[model samples]
Target: MIDNTIFNDKKVAFHTLGCKLNFAETSAIGKQLTDEGFAKVKTGEQADICIINTCSVTDTADHKCRQAINRLNRQHPDAIMIVTGCYAQLKPEEVAAIDGVDLVLGANEKFNVLEYIQKLDGTEKSEIHRSEIKRVREFKPSCSRDDRTRYFLKVQDGCDYFCTYCTIPYARGRSRNATIPETVAMAMQAVEAGAKEIVLSGVNIGDFGKSTGESFFDLVKALDTIPADVRFRISSIEPNLLTDEIITYISTSHRFMPHFHIPLQSGTNEVLQLMKRKYNRELFAHKVELIKSLLPHAFIGVDVIVGVRGETDELFEQSCRFIDSLDISQLHVFTYSERAGTKMLDIEYTVSLNERKRRSNVLHSLSEKKTKAFYQNQVGNTYPVLWESRHNGEFMVGFSSNYVKVERQYDKKLVNTIQIVTLGEWNDDKSALIGV
Candidate 1:
């Protein structure tokens, strides 16, 4: 049996990889440990425990996990190294094979890391316990810590869609959503704790209602009942699942922000079909048009992949043209990186590094233009902004309802409070809004 006494007043460090969801979960875990008397320490410092939250989205991500583990071992050779998250969930054996990893906890067991560590405290052999993710029931609650205005509330978990290029379905299992009442309770708790805005996050937020028979629209309506002070933002959603009813509801809701991020892997029908995406370019464009027609000043973000297999120069140009024509506020450009177990790895088309970089730069340049134009249009408009902590020489910053970044003079009283501000000048150098 392991000893729990070793954890008293112990210091621990956490290293997280991948998505905002992972960051929020890590913060939650840190808070739990802190409440249990564990002190948070900086990475590379001497600590009793080191937790590495791994990601498996790309092969590079796996390499980064190994590197972090090695570096931590070098810094504190005697510390207990714990590996968790997507990479560890999918490949616990790989994580366990590392010389210094004392424990490996999979998806279902990650939340119980402290308990497992207590049990393993003086044990000679490390343990690897990973339950299959498909059997998990409870949704984990995650939110950003203090010192930030916007908190990420993960109301849903897992993905049922097995896209050819995605290993998330395997790592996260089927879709599981938190109960409507539980979600609202947590959201209210966050608001009471000084979170001015909450971003509803998950693996596939569009698939939130599959398990509960309630819809994503229902979640929005429930959140609409929240007192008028706090704003709610939706994270990424699939174009196919973003329905007209949801759009209409958001258009009429006061609490819901007019910012939407829809993933469009490819703009060409053939490329989208090869990628196993559910919707075609026409459907994606129609959604954009519908959102624009309803909320003209809404900030719309699009996700695009540059170097997927079977994407020729002509197809890439077509994708670029299609995005260029959209009324989107910005673009999130992701260069396709093949993962080991994904079906896309077996495909034949090869894109040169130069080509990938070239395509990515093209989209990024267009994104800058689009974002600047959007910000320019917001000049003279009034918006409710949730002021965040001061950064970059201590200038206070926040995000407007349309997702525009606004910067102003620091005020201790304004932190984490949503207040109406008139958009004044555009700081072209900083790519931010100057509010008055």
Candidate 2:
């Protein structure tokens, strides 16, 4: 039995790193703690417990996790520190050994944190509760509101595809999700909670319903029937799983926005094969073309990684040319970083760190041109904008229905409300369309 009195009047602090899924999970954890009589520590205030959710997408991410753990420890010396998430799941002992850490929870154990907190034996030796990734099977659902007007609902978790340079399958385990009805119920609850926009977050949302034997299309259909003003945006989904039928359905959805985020790791089939990606370059291009044909004004974002194990100089140039050929609104570029025990190390060719930065810069410049062009094409067009509660200096910000950022002079009345506005000239960096 756990004692609820121990948690009463205590305070907690949270620091989350990487991805919307992580943010949603952190929020779920926060809610659990707060419901147990713990109050969230405000800015610059110390707490009785600190939870740091770490990411291990790259080596740089691991370093950042360590830095965050240290910074939090120094700031709250008396707090019982806990570490969890992908980093902790991938390297439980390493996280447990971190200075001032009292507990480390793995993917399976994180959801059971309340029980573990009831068993803390102090800092003499940090407690580790980790399980192998292959044995992880339960599907936990999460929904969270960011500092903006958007709510991120975790529809799925984990990955089955063991892409050659990737450790997601190892860190996150197999692809799985809650049933379509359960997921739709979560969305309805978020809508009831005043969510104007909701982003479906997952490691592979398109692969949802693997455990329950339901297709992603079924889930999308159920979410669309929601009788509310809330908008839905799909996060980064695999090109192979993002079928033509799904795109067609979203194009016609009243609740779903005209926005799509797809991951195309490489532009050439050669590099793609080395990475063990499911879809070829031809299939990716066809998907992009299909989206453009159906939703002419859709905001399409693509993810690309530069300088992987087998990407040659000629191949990088070819990839750049292929990316340039796409009608994407923006590019989410990732610079390649070597990870331990991955299949990419066996590949003969490797791009230097400096070379990777150069390749990334090339793609970034191309993306800037693509985005500026996409924004310019929509200038003077009127669209409904959902103003975010978070302020931007003396200005307030909002995103159009099509995912274009628009700004206006600060207005307290505009927070969390949808208003029709005309997009105008680019601001200083042209990052967002000016609201007129």
- What TM-score would every model get versus the actual structure? 0.94, 0.98
In candidate 1, position 15 carries an lDDT of: 86
Q: After superposition, how far is residue 271 of candidate 2 from its true place, in Å?
A: 0.4
Best by TM-score: 2
Local accuracy of candidate 1 as per-residue lDDT tens digits, 1-436: 3344566779998888888888888988888788777888864458888999989887778899999989888877888999999999888888898988999998888888878887785665668989887787667877775346678899889988788788898888889887888889989988888777889999999888888888888898999897747888999999999998999889988889999999998879988988889889999989999999999999999988888888999999998898889999999998888777788877798788789889999999999999989998999999988888766765778888898899888888887778899998876576688999
The residue-level lDDT of candidate 1 at 39 comes to 89
Q: Write the per-residue lDDT of candidate 2 for residues 115-155, one digit (tens) a residue.
A: 89889876479999999999999988999999888999999
CA deviation > 4 Å runs, candidate 2? none
Could you tell me the TM-score of candidate 2? Answer: 0.98
lDDT assessment of candidate 2:
0.92
